[model samples]
Target: MMLRPFSKSGSFYKGNLHGHSSNSDGKFSVSEVIDAYKKRGYDFTCISDHLWIDNRFCAETVTDASKYNTHNFIAINSAELHTRGKKYDKENLWHLVANGLSKDFKPSNDEENIQDLIKRAKGDGAFISIAHPEWYSLTFDEAIMLKDCHSVEIYNHASTVKCNRGSGIYIADFLLNENVKTLLTSTDDSHSLEEDAYGGWVFVKTKELNEKKILKSLIKGDYYSSTGVVIYEVKLEKRLLKLKFSSSNNIMVSGAGHTNISSHGYNLTNAELDLENFDSPFFRITISNQFGKYAWTNPYWFNELDLD
Candidate 1:
């Protein structure tokens, strides 16, 4: 069953959910990161500095609030959960990206479970996602097993470069799960002043520019993912799911249940294909450059409630 393509009714804000700054291990400051995304045409961004949740109230709260309002920014109030020991000389820790948290919300190194971090985030009305799963093996499995992780970064532009792409860590997860519902996300994890940092984005459809509306749509799987390629449209009305590309480059649309067509590739001159009986409830898209580096859309669900 094929349905009409989804059309954009209003403006959509391109955003990044994972970003770093000097508040953590990143080389830049929070304001500097925001300036970079704004200059690059990104409408919104979240700063999840490692192990340090930037509680706006601690220092210069009034000044920071003023700056945020002036820039028209939607800061999600986020932090990165460090699973590794706190001491610098100790073993490393697993990291989870979190937001909408209180300044007092603290987790011990013994409480390294990703689920616990997610629960805390959600309990406080925060939207939670796993950051840079490809960087560490422990976090990658935790991402797959955790129930409420709204999404995970299949591509982390900065981390991927640092880890040399993590030995196909995430691709194997997709292959193992027969009923996976989480959407794939790409984030720049940008700390430096670079425009094309490989991955660093969340595709969302929301007319209102505030934090509540955008975050709601994002957790509900209302958008796709992209590195550089723009997805002009994606819709599912009948038994068919149609995707439209914003460029004439090569693209591929494949999924778990439709004819078992794994990794189907096609060159795009504005092409469209009918996916029949896509009843698996999980589908994704990929757009790649000639170099095989690409962006992957998180698994779009057909008819399932996200229980996390």
Candidate 2:
């Protein structure tokens, strides 16, 4: 069965899940950060500053969600937890984005390991996302060992801005190939709007725009990640998957066991795939524009539906 987020009809709300402010290492304050995204026509934003004790205690200050919400815009309660490996190195940092955290949630002290931190976050009722595996050079073995991770970052705006190594599609694809059941997400992770902001975001389909609704949609994988492209609809019927999307230079369908199909041309807006002949365990759509920007849909697993 197709997930309710894509199968259900509703308004699409755009928002950035990862971003920083002066509360951590960002250049702007919390209010200014909210305004920056609001003026850019975003419907919601999560002020996920680095979760440290010194400067960024977002959990303490990010109370009163309505204070930052505008007429239609919303501010979600979140934070980015930075966990370091027991053996430090260039790739030792593991950044995890936690959304919809409870008010009493507390960050693990320096003595805690990455697994412990993730467990604590989940216990506090927050959605956990493994952030920028590629940038961290996270191996397939390392990624597959992560526990209770709801999603992985396919694209990270800040990592790209600072260093060109941000995309984590390979890691996500590897996990999916192992039947690890996780969603994909992209985020601006923006430290500076001029350089890193607006380059990544997630489009959530929800009946209404509010903190509870948006968080629920995210947890349910009722969303898609994008840099520029927009998908209007994704429909599955009689073993055929069809997509309606904005213009693109190419559209691709990819899955396990070398299952791949692509259409290349200008102004390509729609495509259809016949799953009757597809033997892959799952499949997903990716669209890329001439400018190299891309949009991605969550994978659809064959075992989840009664294909027989």
* Each model's total of backbone clashes: 9, 0
Task: For candidate 2, report its TM-score.
Answer: 0.91
**Whole-model lDDT, candidate 2?**
0.80
Per-residue lDDT over 107-172 for candidate 2, one digit per residue giving the tens place of the 0 to 100 score: 555678888888888877777888878777877777876736989999999888789978988888
TM values, all candidates: 0.77, 0.91
- The prediction achieving the highest lDDT against the true structure is 2
How far out, in Å, is residue 268 in model 2? 1.3
lDDT of 1 at 17: 76
The window of 10 residues in a row where model 1 has the poorest summed lDDT is 57-66
Candidate number achieving the greatest TM-score relative to the actual structure: 2
Candidate 2, pairs of clashing residues: none
